[model samples]
Target: MTDLPSRVSINEEGPREGFQIEPGPIPTADKVALVDALSATGLRHIQVASFVSPKLVPGWADAEAVVAGFAPREGVAYTALWFNGAGLDRALAFRDRLSVTGSISLSASEAFSRRNLNRDREGNLAAMRKQTAAHLAAGVPVRRLGIMAAFGCNFSGEVTPAQVFTAIEDGLSIAAEAGVALTRLSLADTMGWANPVAVERLVGAVRARWPALELTLHLHDTRGMAVANALAALRMGVASFDATVGGLGGCPFAAHKGAPGNIASEELAMLCEEMGIETGIDLDALIEAGHRAERIVGHPLPSALLRGGSLRAMRARMAA
Candidate 1:
């Protein structure tokens, strides 16, 4: 067995990323219930919603309402995603009232940057810089800077490692210039194009380059490699990951519409538990939450843990 971290951290993004791509709008009350459920499951971080244009994502238009609905737990940290100054403004307005952290996401691939945010690479970087500074100024802790499409892009096909490096450098430079310390840095495989080999290679390079920064992987299971890629990352010392409940989330702007969403949080946690790596998550409660997510989304989710019972339960059943 490869040496692993004593305790792994998982950030549940189901309330935001997972629900963002759903065709039907999830009611604010239901979204709040799902988030509240996740928060109670010993998850330290939960991304509640994104502050984006209602025109672009009608589902999250009730971002404020969702924030208002969920009861805040003392130990759990709530987060909101913002891509630009406008989104930052929305988050800032609620900063005092809500217990929320902030995330600033920028795409590495110029093609995706343009398609997703109507900006080129440089433009997106500039926006990220501005948003990061603004978020800090507003007293919202910008915990993470998400580099989207770091592994590869749907539009551009293969993204070079150097490009990903440059983007991270630029983002770090901006953060330094603004005199803000980032708590985490995330590399997102937005298109699910990363393989296990690629994951090790990229994660190794980044760890070598920036040893101090906390690293997280945001993976998509479009090609059924999300878990494999995650395992590869874990071997390379990436202890933090972003996963959605019931495997619900996908980028609507990506080239492939049928691509799967983020890896299921329950499934990942179960894998960690079975491997003897601690995640501090209640497996049964998490599976129950996954079932709740399925009810809210009104569809069958893609969670192996939800479909196949936990390891112990399955073993007990077989023995019986």
Candidate 2:
């Protein structure tokens, strides 16, 4: 394995991304407690919840409540996902304390876009453009504008790199014209179809276009390539990544069964630590958190750390 930059940023999406996929509804109180515990782990940036329609995602019904209940910790920034103007307005109501922001996703393929966003790619972008203007006028920050399904799609197969670039330009163009400071922009592998080579190429292409914009990688372990793809992204200086605690998330439309949420946070932290990268996270604490999350979800997590020890132990000593 190759070494990484000394300092790195890890975004905890356990509360928002993890429970959002579980079969049973996670209680709002438990969600608040989990976010509180995560804050103590020294991870300042935590995606607490999503402000989506309760009917569609019942698990996130208590988003506003959880945001209100979780007290702010020093050095911690809490985030909520807002779909559009109404969602952004709901998030802004709590903007005084929690860091309320959102992600706008546009699939590379039209069919996938309709399946994921209930609209075509251009329609999604057009709606987000109007919302972007509103957010800017209200002085609310749009933490991350994500281009979802950038890598590939479950229904449409491999998404072209050109299409991904177009979405990035579209998102940036609106953010610029609206005078909105983008906290981050991420490429989400909503379908878990990205390989290491694809990740490297896509990330490199994005860096070439918007080198100054902070980039994040959100991957799924559908084909068991999340870790490898993430490592490749790290090699490209893509530091920030979105990972759940126990590998607990699946796209509502990205196929059924356990696809595993981005690489588990514990596993990512372990890899980063061994590679001399500082994630500012407590490895043991993160593992414990993963265990707690596994219990809440009532399923065995798809985490390498939970299954085995450090990678060094997996390899035998070289013959002398």
Worst 10 residues of 2 by lDDT: 311-320
Residue-by-residue lDDT tens digits, candidate 1, 1-320: 46577689998999898678888778888999998899888898899998889998898899989887888888787878766678777777777545556566767788888877689877876777777767777776766678999988878878877888888877777777877777788999988889989988888888788888889999888777888888888888789999998888765544566556899998889878887889989877888899999899888887777888788667778999
- Choose the strongest candidate by lDDT: 1
Pairs with backbone N, CA or C atoms under 3 Å apart (clashes), candidate 2: none
lDDT against the true structure, per candidate, is 0.82, 0.78
Residue pairs that clash (backbone atoms under 3 angstroms), model 1: none
Candidate 2 per-residue lDDT, tens place, 1-320, comes to: 35355777888888888767787777878788788878877786899988888888888988888999997998888887777677777888888667755455566666787875678766887888877667767876665678888888777788988988888777777777776666677888887889999998998887787777888888888778888888898888888888887676765554666657677887888878888888888777777777777777777888878767545444433332
TM-score between candidate 1 and the true structure: 0.92
For candidate 2, give the lDDT of residue 175: 73
Predictions: Cα RMSD each: 2.1, 3.7
Q: Local error of candidate 1 at 245, Å? A: 0.8
| lDDT (Cα) of model 1 | 0.82
As a TM-score, model 2 comes out at 0.90
